[model samples]
Target: MAENYVLRTQRLLSKLPFSSWLFGKVISRRAPYFGTITPRITQVIPGKCECLIRKRRGVENHIGTVHVIAIANGLEMAMGTMAEASIPRHLRWIPKGMTLDYTAKAGSDIRCVAEVDQSAWQVGDMPVTVTALDDNDTVVVKGSINLWISEKPSK
Candidate 1:
């Protein structure tokens, strides 16, 4: 029954304009954000994804602005979803490395988007680049996430 439900959900999500909508709905319902840095997955495609987060007092740093780590979380959400959705269900992936660059301050809502060149993707290792932008449409943070993808070894 659970497998059937998963298939149904996947099918429905594929039909929609935004794949992240399903991912966000699922994650939010199962394990909602614990901090003020809540992210909403907006769209997901073969090699790209988008997510958003609203800045709040709870997410402020010492400077009284949106925290850098909070933006990183949003970037991860976007990149991870893109990488995971790229592979087939029979395969699995785990993040291997992440490099982050804080470019600017975030004072309002933020959007994180990620893209992976399909031609550059392989079954072994793939690099997904994610970028977070503030409400003004300026990049605040950038992340390069490495994912290790492979099939479950026979036991």
Candidate 2:
């Protein structure tokens, strides 16, 4: 059988120079809204994923800080990639909802991370922990993204 798409894509892109940028570009093409923050998908592995978004004018709010919504987009991207890379081939998953809290101001570039325990994959609702951290490693946003995991329909 072919490799999982998310895992395969990450492996292929990491072989190239500026792989993070290229990978994010490719993903944004597949999900156009993620392009709004110009994220760089730095990692996508089973159980975890990381995405980085620079502190740029486009993502800045009126107060000259990275907008919370932009950070949210990054978080969702990381969660989706992590789920896709980690889930068993027999399973399928989709986002059900998200609950986020803005804990601190995002004063610098942000790194969004999504993580799930290896044993957490099952046929049910799972809460994936996600966080957006500033360059100083301060948690600016903390949340859990709810995902519905189920057995894939028989072909």
Q: Write the per-residue lDDT of candidate 1 for residues 108-152, one digit (tens) a residue.
A: 888889898866555788788889888889988887988887886
Candidate 1's C-alpha runs over 4 A off are 1-25, 29-36
- Estimated TM-score for each candidate: 0.77, 0.96
- Each candidate: what lDDT? 0.73, 0.93
Off by over 4 Å in 2: none
How many clashes (backbone atoms < 3 Å, residues ≥3 apart in a chain or on different chains) does model 1 have? Answer: 0
Candidate 2 residue-wise lDDT, 1-155, digit = tens: 25688878888888999999999998888889999999899888889999999999999999999999999999999998788788998888989999999999999999999999979999999999999999999999999999999999999
Q: Model 1 compared with the native: what TM-score?
A: 0.77
* Error of model 1, residue 77, in angstroms: 1.1
lDDT of 1 at 103: 87
Which candidate leads in lDDT? 2
